[model samples]
Target: MPAKKPFALRLDEKMMQAVEKWAADEFRSTNGQIEWLIHEALKKAGRLKDTKEGGRMKDEG
Candidate 1:
């Protein structure tokens, strides 16, 4: 596991509640859920450098 850095996020109450609910449903802490979301976004944008497999973005031909 890599080291995690802590930071502050100022989400409004509604947004925070939604995130908390999502985290609970997923059996993850709110921080873990947010980390997963960011990682997925970066992977979708071709910004991830360490993909274990190279053919993930290929068409299913």
Candidate 2:
């Protein structure tokens, strides 16, 4: 595993609220949920290369 990198992500109020609710319902941190969404999208497009998951974890881990 590599060291986790940190950066700022700006979201509109409405979008942020939706993501927050979804994350809560799924018992995942907002960051984790977002990562999972991105990972799934990449997989659907055949862009993920990492065996461990290209840029995200498979679970809410």
Candidate 3:
């Protein structure tokens, strides 16, 4: 596992609401959904690293 970084995130009211709804729909915590969204965005930008424990790169497809 990689070292985790801590930082602050500021979301506008509407954006936060949308994320909350999406998180509920996906049965994931809001923080988890945010992490997933960040990971996905990074992957799309070719900035995400691959993991050995079955975590594949998004672009591998």
Candidate 4:
């Protein structure tokens, strides 16, 4: 697994509630759901590059 950096995130109460509910429905932790959402968005936007190990590669450039 790649190293993960932690950061503070502030969300509206309603949005946080919605994300919590969605995470529960998907059997994922709220943090995991957020990460998945971001990863999916990056993939859709062609911002992620797949590696031979089937993992995402970070653009260090």
Clashing residue pairs in candidate 2 (N, C-alpha, C atoms within 3 angstroms): none
Supply candidate 1's per-residue lDDT for 44.
82
State the weakest 10-residue window (summed lDDT) of model 2: 52-61
Report the Cα lDDT for residue 37, model 2.
86
Question: Which ten-residue region of model 4 has the weakest summed lDDT?
Answer: 52-61
Candidate 3 pairs with clashing backbones: none
Off by over 4 Å in 4: 52-61
Candidate 2 residues 27-47, lDDT tens each? 999999998888778878878
**lDDT comparing candidate 3 with the true structure:** 0.84
Candidate 3 runs further than 4 Å off = 50-61
Q: Write the per-residue lDDT of candidate 1 for residues 1-61, one digit (tens) a residue.
A: 5698888989999998998899999999999898888877887887867545476643212
Which pairs of residues collide in model 1? Answer: none
lDDT of 4 at 13: 98
In candidate 4, position 33 carries an lDDT of 96
- Please, what are the lDDT tens digits per residue for candidate 4 over residues 1-61? 7899999999999999999999999999999999988988987898787653435354322
TM-score for all predictions? 0.73, 0.74, 0.73, 0.81
Residue-pair clashes per candidate: 0, 0, 0, 0
